[model samples]
Target: MQVTTATEAALLTSREIITGEELGSVPLATPGAVAAAARRAAAAAPAWAARPAAERAAILSRAAELLLERDQEAMDLLVREGGSITGKAFYEVHAGAAELRHAAALATGPDSPHGPGSEPGRETEVSRVPLGVVGVIVPWNFPLLLGMRSVAPALALGNTVLLKPDPHTPLSGGRLFAEVLADAGLPEGVLEVVHGDADAGAALVQAPDVAMVSFTGSTEVGREIGATAGRLLKRVVLELGGQNAFVVLPDADIEQAASAGSWGSFLHQGQICMAARRHLVHQDVVEAYTETLARRAAALRIGDPYRTDAQIGPVIEHGALTRIAAAVEEAVAQGARLVTGGRMQGPFFPPTVLADVTPKMAVFHKEVFGPVAAITAFADDDEAIALANTSDYGLTAAVYTSDADRGRALAPRLRCGVVHVGDQTVNHDPALPFGGIGASGNASGFGGRAALDAFTRWHTLTTSSPARAYPF
Candidate 1:
């Protein structure tokens, strides 16, 4: 990996999520070093941007190939460092590679078009220009794919990037990218990994040389970064938290709805931003849905992610596990029923289902990033929509119904960035623009053609054959 290995004042130790065995430690970059990295990226941006678009595209394409070539290693890193199950880890490898390939296409995509000027003998054209230096701060949930969402596109668009990954998953989130890119022949200093916590992240956002910052994490942290970037007049993209709803209409198939809801609530142990935190089901069928969901929750096998039989794995850390347990306890105290799986075995939290959950319960309104599905009953469509839209978060939502047209109609009414009909909330595509609104984010999305807009600014140029004489 090409990460900064310089020994410094503080150190971040990486441990296996399941075993808690100390794997390694890396020196943490101070705020001053982070600023210096930004300056270095700024200095390197020009030469990188000056390269032909095809050459830039070629590098990204090769980076994708290299990542796929090392898929097993990358997947293992994700499973060990990021607590992703083997299947999810494999998904990360391919999804991350897809993001790189998508960025490669962006590199050689058509330029902005020219237009006729208002006056004769005049020509006008608009072009997209890089932001110079970009700061990308990603969280640990799906580190590789999330990091690639910002890093690959920023690099492909001719800007140098300074990546700051969450300390907990540094290897999968940051260093792995550096290794793959370097192997793919990326120029030195075009991309650098600054490993630290809030200190390093804040430094990168406030660094004068960084023209833009793309952050994915908690809403609280995203708000702080937004304020800092605003004061500094830097461009910012924030993809924050979500308390997304998995709505089951009365007409929905109970079996299908329960299965989809179970996967949505418990996949990756429900640590995803788009994980279905709330199950808003119609009162007519709430009982059957809850029972089936609880059965699936109880059936999931929780163990080491490396184990082929383990469907659920350990959470990121003890603190997160504690918070998750506390949330469930508080919900039960507030009159929520624990249908099944409320306990933890070591670091593994088995899939949990909370029935009779009311809005008054903390788990009903707040996001508990664990394998807990809080179920609430709604009397009708209006009530279901109201309950679904109750949260301040608006990242993603899912609607389940036999009638496709009815699901489509209700999709728009739900307040979220992406709504899936007859599917789970945790879904991603590098070719689709993804983001959220309200406390979730500021709606500066990522992926596809939207990536071009996120990483570049428009520049207009005008030309005339001859200058007109002034009145004076």
Candidate 2:
């Protein structure tokens, strides 16, 4: 097995790598190599699409079993390659395996809502068919889960896939997945893993034979891919960036709200797009809630990602750490006060809590992809709603209120795609639709059954008796 390194490129974290080996230099894939992989996928797509749904499902199920069997190895790779805590990696593997199982179940069941069904008199049938080839561009955060989320469904739907995992964590997850699928008896060229950077991603998206492109990354990159796919007239599913808000109401339990805020903001070192970035608290409970949150934030255990007791880990790389530090510094300079945990040690930035953060501060308005939480006090219900909806993002939001009426009422008013009451927004069930609106890229909805739909194209088959034939 030959491992080749492309030109050295700089990452947001200032970390560099060559052939999956980090050496304080950024790594990238050459345009020719990515294009070749795309071509290979395109060439093999039709044959893959011809495979029966049952066969596809069986193979995917085998892959799932393999993943479960190698759970520890997967978790370790996730932690080392993606910079996530051991617990988080465990959850990733579990969720990813579950996704594969669900997708397999869906494949063997029916042809979706559009599939053929029995009727008493009428001969009507609809079918769910593969859309040839799919290109999945995954992110560094939750690398294993997100990559599998897109790939498993696409493969289950009988579509060949060219998956380009995030360059930062490509070899660990991507190589493992490819090996598993191959060992599970999946047809060669049906599932391919390409390692590279943005040029590689662009090649996958622009490949003329690709039927759809599914991407999970920042909003800026999503826009670029969406525009390219639009020009090519190919379907696209994008899960982009988010600046989710966590609203703490006057009647909320201060302790519960504080705990949710701490976990929601610092989980995965706050690299999650759905992680609560803004903390909008009611004036009545603001002081107490802030105090509790600050105390909890400071107490978080940050160490190597492989440590079981480590609650927080490094921010992917040093460049990510730098960007997060700069965001906090700018926010403080603009008037926000850092309550605790703003300093950086290696790639780890201690869980940070910022108080008195007005909407004007960058930390309040932008997606600070780090373990930083910005707190602002709102005087009343209307003010809280306004503050929460002020951001350009509407991916996810949370409202903490004990009153049933208040919680229900506020839920509908939130501009986000998903909302949780009395809890910080972190719920991601494989059965429910998950995607966002506004600046969060336009995929409409995805996840669970919706994600399965994204991997297919519908075809209607209507028949009529000879006597009822239409006149030409």
TM-score of each: 0.96, 0.90
Candidate 1 lDDT tens digits, 296-365: 8888888887765689988888888889899989999999999998887888888999999988778877
lDDT of 2 at 151: 89
At residue 88, candidate 1 shows an lDDT of 90
Residue 399 in model 1: shift from native, Å? 0.6
Task: Tell me, by TM-score, which candidate is best.
Answer: 1
Residue 386 local lDDT, model 1: 92
Assess the local accuracy of residue 281 in candidate 1 as a C-alpha lDDT between 0 and 100.
Answer: 91
- What stretches of model 1 exceed 4 Å from their correct place? 1-10, 112-117
TM-score of 1: 0.96
Q: Report backbone clashes per prediction.
A: 0, 5
Candidate 1: residue pairs that collide: none
- lDDT by residue (tens digit), candidate 2, 1-472: 1234444542322122212334222234466666677778878888877877788889889988998899988887777677778788889998988888888887887556643456544577777788888888889888888888888888888788988877777655577789788888888788877777687889889877678998989999998999999999999988888889999988888888899998899999999989999999988888899899999998888887565478887777778889999999999999998899888887689999999999877888889899999999999889988999998888889998888678889888889788888788877776778888878767443566787678887777767565364578
